[model samples]
Target: MLIKTIFAGFGGQGVLSMGYVLAYAAMVEGLQVTYLPSYGAEVRGGTANCTVAISNEEIASPIASAPDNVVVMNNPSLEKFQHQILTGGVMFINTNLVESRPVRGDIVLYEIPCNDLAHDLGSDQSANMVMLGGFIEKTGLVKMESVRSAIGDVFKEKKKAKEMNLKALDVGFDYMRNNGGKA
Candidate 1:
């Protein structure tokens, strides 16, 4: 099956990293994947968004006008892209930062307390990964092992950033395992 996901938020929320991690996880699962990020200009106003496509076959388009899944990390991002998701799609909203309700009741809405959870895990910056963990767990689009490795792969060269990122991933994964995507 093909899965299209879009993650959008303001700058410094790890929006691009979320898409990168998801795509890398799909690749580790031996699937075809494409990750496209929109930045530079969009970040001028503090918006950052990215599209990730994963499929069993070749993905012709890297862009998703209506994604099957969406991760929104801010109120503006949520309000801007909530309507762009397809009916019956799954959405992960950062409840800590965004208190407003989503537009679609038909779709599955996960009000994830990402910021709070990340802070509890010792870093307020890891909220995006926490939200992603819940989404990944619910969708099962990627394997846990693959997700872990992907986090390492992204941060290995950075040295100083590796521990923090992997720890964040684990915290997010552990939260999902414990909470089962609720609360």
Candidate 2:
């Protein structure tokens, strides 16, 4: 199975980090993966995004013209990438920061209040993990153990932040399982 996903948000929102962790996890799971990151001139509070391609077979291209899934963390990202999702694709929106909803009917939409959920978990910075959790659960592309392992490896430099991020991932995963990932 091939899953091409794009994660977008302003800088410092862990947008690239999420993609990094996912790509790492996919690699650890023995899958072929590719990651491409983009950002605006400004580092923080500027547009940032990454495209990840995960597949069981060899991938010929790294670019994703029409992503199979999308995770939009802010309003601008929602506006920018909402229309680029393929028909019957899955889109996860962070409701805490993104007020706009997807207009497409063919795709599945999951409105996850990532920031709020992360805040509730006592760390607003981990909002991306919450969204990542939902995406992981919804897509079932990567296993939880692999994600958790990647998180530990990804955040190895910042030991104090790892626990909360793992909790945030669990919160996102549980939220999707309980709430149902549907519009």
User: How many steric clashes between backbone atoms does each model show?
Assistant: 0, 0
Q: Please report, in order, the local distance difference test score of every candidate based on alpha carbons.
A: 0.83, 0.92
How high is each candidate's TM-score? 0.91, 0.97
- The clash tally of candidate 2 reads 0
What TM-score, to 2 decimals, does candidate 1 have?
0.91
Q: What is the lDDT of residue 83 in candidate 1?
A: 89
Measured over all alpha carbons after superposition, the RMSD of each candidate to the real structure, in angstroms, is 1.8, 1.0
Please provide, for model 1 over 42-135, each residue's C-alpha lDDT reduced to its tens digit, 9 standing for 90 to 100: 5445789999999999899999988999888888988888889999998887877887878667788766688888888788778878877787
State the RMSD for candidate 1.
1.8
Pairs that collide, model 1: none
Candidate that would win on TM-score:
2
lDDT over C-alpha atoms for residue 81 of model 2? 91
Model 2 over residues 1-183: C-alpha lDDT tens digits? 888999999999999999999999999899999999999999799999999999999998998899999999999998899889999998999888988888778888988899989999989899999999999998988999999999999889988788888999999999999998576
